[model samples]
Target: MWEVRLAKHLKADLGTDTFDLVQVPTPEPAAGEVLVRTDYLGLSVAYLEMLRADSRLPIPPWEVGQRIGGGAVGTVVRSNSAELAVGDLVRTMAGWCEYSTGPADQYPGLDPDLFPSPVHYLSQGPTAYYGMSEVAKAGAGDVVFVSGAAGGVGSLAGQIATCRGAAKVIGSAGSQAKIDYLVDELGFDAAFDYHDGPVLDHLRELAPEGITVFFDNVGGEQFDAAVEAAAPGARFALCGALATQIGDHEDRFPEPDLTAAAAKGIAVLPFSTYHTPEQVAAWTEHFSTWLSEDRFVFPHTIVEGGLSAAPQALVSLLKGSFKGNVSVRVAS
Candidate 1:
């Protein structure tokens, strides 16, 4: 079996040279665990930042050559639990390697039957589900705005808001094509190219009345603009700061213009999807229902190259080269 594991926390760059891809004897499933032959791995911004030397997460020296951690969708080549079968395709927080092993106890909520065969569900599904269902609390007839609207979580956030009955869902993307896709396919009420000009100006024009909710994925300028354009009493869900956390860069959140937010009595709160497995399970059910019912849709940015390409894909995703959830195709 081939595995692409991190050599160490990288500082200069994370392209081909940063990892160690080696052929190793495949390990079998341990008791209460499952061994998956990974087909797709999600490249997340959090992991990208963690790959940096000054990362908030300190890496253990002994584990310096370990596999990069995140989520993957794959087929169960071997399983010890009756809940999972040999061909079951499932999603798990495994790694960027071609195969992964983890305890089944941690992922009790996901349907084991959905694995090995590619279902509509993947990395973006749960994120869209949890962010909107829990943090954003978006509902039908509400007007919503999502920053970084073309990225993985942002794209799904927009769609989930739409599915929940938002009267108008506005999305801000980096490119015109992404904007078009949002409006034409994803059912956004309005879409804007953030590069065009001031985000606040564009948002005000689109949402002249006000916005009921703001699901923000990118921080920095977008956060500032969302604060400025937020409708009175708006629910501001702070999910990520992709724009601000670029390449060894960091920025502080500006002091809330209390006067501005006070005008609307808006609520600005930050949340992480890693709250609890119980929460993930509940949120997954909600989003999965929407997905199973065809009420929501997501776009995946897939780069096929197996595990060796994992490092570059992570860099491209963080640099905004990929338009949606970055996935590494390991097989099929």
Candidate 2:
């Protein structure tokens, strides 16, 4: 067995402050499994929150020195399943590691034909694909508002909405820089800062007619604002709650004003991208096509180093120190 598995671990306090980087023995994939050489590990605001609040997610305790990050891109070094081949570049849920072993079925949507650049496929492919098809339900004539608009998912979601014929696309971000980029570059009708006073107030001014479709990436106050500003007969897609809960702060999930939604006949549908395998496949198809055409962009923040840097990187991502999808380069 090869040794030296440096991994990031989330400890008892559930804060990045307690994270540890340690070494272990590498293991081989069993039957039906594949061993991969990790290249990049994707981080999410939601995942960082879950790391801070271990009780909030459905995952188990972080083993003494097990990896804590998830969503990675890697090359298959060994494969026991026909679905994957050695040297195949793929994306998987395996976290901050140089190498990992898991069932081939655990990862999906890896293009059988290798891409010109494997890193792009690993970081943005699944996230963009998942958000457009499942989270947004993008279609023509819909008015869509995407929060965290410059993010990996939000950027793709915005483009997908436009392609589907949305009448107007509005987005919210953390900075004026992002706001300008969303409108001038990403085709949003209007973009505003989340901290520019109250979101509801700004949204009301921009969308006097109200939004017909709201794709929520930042929950908490933003979610509340969506509920209040929804047009009659609106379709609300609740994809992520990045703002409300962090670590033990999950109980702070903003109470939605359902009364207003009911009065307007609005429909709220909250879902996770990982809710089903079929959903993942559906997203992958949409993403692959859009990505090939350069219609979607996946904004990312690459935190250098490997597992040793995961804790700080995750903390920075959760604190909004960096914009877009956050990832750590674990190998190569």
Candidate 3:
């Protein structure tokens, strides 16, 4: 078996040297435990931020030569629990490894008939569903704006807003191709390339009347623009600070001038997938239904080389080299 370990706390940009691939003897499952043969691994900005020395996540600080934590989808090659059987697909937080062993209680079984693929639960599906439908409460006649709209969660957020009956959906991305993808492929009502000029100007031009809901992913300048452009009684879901993740800053994100947001009576809600089992279940059902009906579009980029490729894959995703959701194929 092979596993990826944090070589050291990252002081600069992430690269292949940040992690080390090492061999380890495979372990057998114990009582109430299962051995998973990893098939796919999910990468996100959160995972990259965790490698930093100043990570604010509740989890203990990362140490040298420790297995990095992440989400992965695999099969139960060996099982000791009554709830699981051999060949069952499951999702786990144990990632960047060829094989993983954990309590059966920890691995949530997935039905192929419903999910079809394990990567569906990785980042885009549940995050988008919960952020847009539950946290943001996007509804009919609402004008919605999603920052980082070309990325995994943002791409899905825009489409989910449309599925929820939002009157107009606006998106901000880094490039013209992404803008075209958002408007032409994902059904965003309007899309803009933030790099073309100041984000505030772009937002005002695209959403002159103001936006009712903002699904924020790339904080900093875009966040300030969204706050400045927020309509009265608007709602905002603070999903991710992608700009901060890649920037050379110790602060989590840039502070937005909230005078306009306060005057407008807007509600800003910070959301996390952790400790949200009820919301997870609800959104999972909703996502499954929408997916079955073909009412949502999910675009993903798959990188090869299994566990050894995860570091570069994550770097590519954070550098905006890959559009859409990113996943590493560990096996067939």
- The model with the greatest TM-score is 3
Question: If candidate 3 were superposed on the true structure by all CA atoms, what would the RMSD be?
Answer: 1.8
Better of 1 and 3 by lDDT: 3
Whichever of 1 and 2 has more lDDT, that candidate is: 1
Better candidate by TM-score, 1 or 2: 1
Q: Root-mean-square deviation of each candidate, in angstroms?
A: 3.3, 3.6, 1.8
List the pairs of residues colliding in candidate 1. 88-115, 89-115, 89-116, 90-115, 140-165, 141-165, 232-264, 233-264
CA lDDT of each prediction against the hidden true structure: 0.73, 0.69, 0.84
Clashing pairs in 2: 52-247, 53-247
Candidates arranged by TM-score, highest first: 3, 1, 2
Model 1 lDDT per residue over 235-300, tens place: 888877766554444432344455666676888877766635676566566666776777766577
Worst 10 residues of 1 by lDDT: 112-121
Q: Highest lDDT among the candidates is held by which one?
A: 3
lDDT of 3 by residue, 243-331 (tens): 87645555666666677778889998878766367766776787788878988766788889878888888888888888788999987
Any residue pairs clashing in model 3, and if so which? none
Greater lDDT among 2 and 3 belongs to 3
Candidate 2 vs candidate 3, TM-score winner: 3
Model 2: per-residue Cα lDDT over 119-170, one tens digit each: 5554443544465555556677777888888776787677778877888889
Where is model 1 more than 4 Å wrong at Cα?
12-14, 29-34, 56-63, 79-84, 102-119, 247-259
> Roughly what TM-score does model 1 have, to 2 decimal places?
0.85
